[model samples]
Target: MRFKYSIPVVFVLALVIIEKENNIISKVSDKLVLKQPPMVLDSSSSLQLLLKPNQSVPSFHFHPRTSAPVFTLMKRRLEDYSSHQPRTQKPKQKHILLLATTRTGSSFVGEFFNQQGDNMFYLFEPLWHVEKMLTLEGGGTNASASAKAYRNVLQQLFLCDFSLLESFIDPPPVDHITSNLFRRWSSSSLCADSVCSPFVQGDFEKFHCKARKCGPLNLTLAAQSCRAKQHRAIKSVRVRQLDMLRPLAEDPRLDVKFIHLVRDPRAVLASRMVAFEKYKNWKEWGTRGGDVPLDDDEVMKLKGNCDNIRMSAQTGLRQPKWLRGRYLLVRYEDIARFPMRKAAEMYRFAGMPFTPQVKSWIARNTQVSPKEASGVYSLQRNSSEHVEKWRFSLPFKIAQVVQRVCRPTLKLFGYKVVNSEKMLTDRSISLIEDKVFNSL
Candidate 1:
């Protein structure tokens, strides 16, 4: 069997090389500069842009090496604030939000963005309330315990200093002294309304407030916050909640942007199945809905749920036109296959300053080459060819049942359905007979 890295191996090597070149001499002591410069028009770049529901562009250009701002700027608060200050020095802050789904490579993207020196503070999914839930789950703490815990977590995270994070990853200070009282006070005074406190001020404040004094994040008015590194990016999957976003959008201080990512249901499902089989051995004892092997019924239902989520997201995006262009959908297939080009596109969309480093990074990390195997569901790649294994991985009748259950919603996201007549055809029968014969 020709086993290789699940994603492109070449891209991984490029990343390692780039890491070494960037003075990432030690893994533990240094935080990798994860973020790339924003996208600009590069004539040498390739890969086609897949349009979102409301984005309109005549022609998109990918530059080989040019200083182009990657994303559309809704507004630049710090730059404006600096204009009001004494001309002795300039002040600037950039706030970026990466609105993504689970398993959409957000952490990788955030890591790239975090490398912008002290200019950008990349916040991982540090929602403390959620983190503290393991303990909370043990008892009936309060009637609104979950909500209160979530709120408290948000408050703490928003107030925590992000600069300390870089140090945490590569600690110079054994126990970096931070004043939690100061943070709590800062959290209260900075934004009064608990609901609008983090950004206006809400959950994220649980993380962002402390950076004000403990680290470089100075707690000044939005107009005067000149720690150029004042700019921050939140990479969290939970931000998909529209209710959560609506409040943050209302905050006058924040220049919020959303980057939404998507993937083909077929590809996602295939990858997920492979992951499940490898990790859980779901096949050996059967799956959740059945004590016996999964029937077609279960597989079909899985497909339907996946498709429905994507379609609902698509539909939901249309109603909120304010999120147009700002809320971009990235296909996982494109990211895996043409990472450099895709990275360039994302840089451009985010309005960050793109540099040669980005080009070098893309050349190294983007998966621009063809894939040798589409994955486990293939013949030539491996003898364990479950390629379309969905056909035989489950009981034939159950598989059919799953297909029927999920059929209505499956095609919307690009899944093809095999009719009942075709299931009993010569090819299908032969494949099944072979599987059953092999088993005996």
Candidate 2:
């Protein structure tokens, strides 16, 4: 008897796509609830990295020919490695780093790669470790020295290349889509462990951050061992602290990939305002003190927070043009345009291998349309209506205020405010008051 293989056998071996539209049970104003794919991997392969309301697990399937390994198998292997377990002796060279502001789709992008198995480690907020020395034992009694240690720890953690240190710093970058300021810091000479700036002296340390005991020597060994540790790494951190990343990126060992994910200001503003309004006032809504009602000062502080992040995001996109070859600007509109294409490009940019199954997995799980079809087999285009829904969703007065504040930045991203004349003419609404119109 001869062994025979057939297409039906291949199809049977393939994992079917899951449709998620009907499953989208909730829709928050500006934020759309993505339908979860029914075809989830086993719990062992699933990662708990995602924040709630957007909790997702990366899924994979195997190729039919050559009995290629199942996507899920790769996912499991990676999970083991990230958690610090050994899978294979061979080291992989492709490492990727993603840099972006909050709410700019960095989380989702990181998640996409993470689902691919032991290839990429999704490191969120790599700077937090260094910044935490102020609270840790033996960090330092003096604020200045403490700050230096904090910065040093962060540098070594990210650049030193230890799997254990991955817990402390973001993995190296094969690609980085970071803000201009962050790119500046990550590329700075002063960020090194040895170069303790004056800021790390006297009172400066109290205000700034530095790394701890993990200096250049220990970091070097870690870096050598973990150099080819993960297939790739993605870093999505706040823009305010980008200045710290300067030194580590200088090393020839670090390969940084840049991807800028931007959303239309109107939508971003709408989404943010709604989130704040709902969460900030939760206590008043009787959620058992879950939400805190903020006074004018608090509201102002929140507004500033929003403005800072938005400004950082805007600056990140603009700054890369000066270094065009190293960066790629991707709009939320475009990513939403054909998420699969954008995802594939991102994978290629990160130097990771994109399996056919991964492509299928994205199509099925990332469906975001009115239609109910969602699964590895189905694909949908980005909803244009969602792109500028803020025009209608946000109140006119608030929209005006947002426009006043965000207009200049919006222009930087290639968008112009709709002037009153254009709004009146376009909507065909008379500007004159009703009484004046009647008298006329």
Judged by whole-model lDDT over C-alpha atoms, candidate 2 comes out at 0.43
The clash number for model 1 is: 61
Worst 10 residues of 1 by lDDT: 431-440
C-alpha positional error of residue 6 in candidate 2 after TM-score superposition, expressed in Å: 58
Q: Give the TM-score of candidate 2.
A: 0.46
Looking at model 2, residue 88 earns an lDDT score of 60
User: In terms of TM-score, which candidate is strongest?
Assistant: 2
| Residue 381 accuracy (lDDT) in model 1 | 26
Q: Residue by residue across 1-440, what tens digits does model 1's lDDT show?
A: 11233113323333444433422322211211122234432321111122223333223223235433221110122224323544454444445666555544555565445544444545556442243342345542332444343334333333334332323222122243222212232222222222122233222322345334222223232212223345566565543243335445444555555665554333344345555544244343335554434454545445545554555456435646545445555544455555666677766767776556545644444332225445332211221232243444444443454445555534433345555645633244422111100100
List lDDT for all candidates, in order. Answer: 0.41, 0.43
The residue-by-residue lDDT of candidate 2 on 254-312, one tens digit each, is 55555556555555656655545543432233224232334444345445644654554
Q: After superposition, how far is residue 416 of candidate 2 from its true place, in Å?
A: 3.5
